[model samples]
Target: MRAGGNIEITDLMRFGHLAAAVFAGWILIAPSIDCARRGLQRETPLSEWEHMDTFTTQQGCESYRATVIEAEKADSKNLYNARYAYSLCVRDDDPRIKGE
Candidate 1:
């Protein structure tokens, strides 16, 4: 069978394909735009916490401490990054730039 010329599609199939395309586009673009707007940036990988001393001993105790540390570190990094991005956005958009 030949490919890449033209394929037949029913009306329902065409609508379904269009809906899927739109849904996929929104799934891809919405989070990124929200991230840019709110500065919900990605944090550095901290999987090393799993192998740290505090976590390498007792499995349960270690897992708890590791989770706490990892969460705190992630929170810290997120706050700093978000503030930095917000400051940048604010600087660009501030009306005080006109020297009023």
Candidate 2:
């Protein structure tokens, strides 16, 4: 019998392999977990802007503008126009609204 009761060499090897697999999995997933944490942090403040119907990134605001413009060009009336206008109104208000 081993020091830990009946744990043999094979059992120790299996435990080592399991530990290594778990470590590797954590390494692979760590970056994504960090990215999600950062994304959440960035999004939390932007939620306040959401209530005012605005975007937190230039790309987002520009995309909204383009959609509205396209809708107008097609002579299609929709809510995108108002959203684009609102985005424009708040575009320069938050400098931290760069991007992710």
Q: Say which candidate scores most in TM-score.
A: 2
What count of clashes does model 2 give? 0
Off by over 4 Å in 2: 1-52, 76-100
RMSD from true fold, candidate 1: 17.0
Question: What is the per-residue lDDT of model 2 for residues 13-34, given as tens digits with 9 covering 90 to 100?
Answer: 9999897645431000000112
Q: What residue pairs are clashing in model 2? A: none
- lDDT per residue for candidate 1 within 34-89, as digits (tens), equals 44556432341221111212211234443554454465565665653333332211
lDDT scores for all predictions? Answer: 0.34, 0.42
Report the poorest 10 consecutive residues by lDDT, candidate 2.
25-34
Give the lDDT of residue 74 in candidate 2.
51
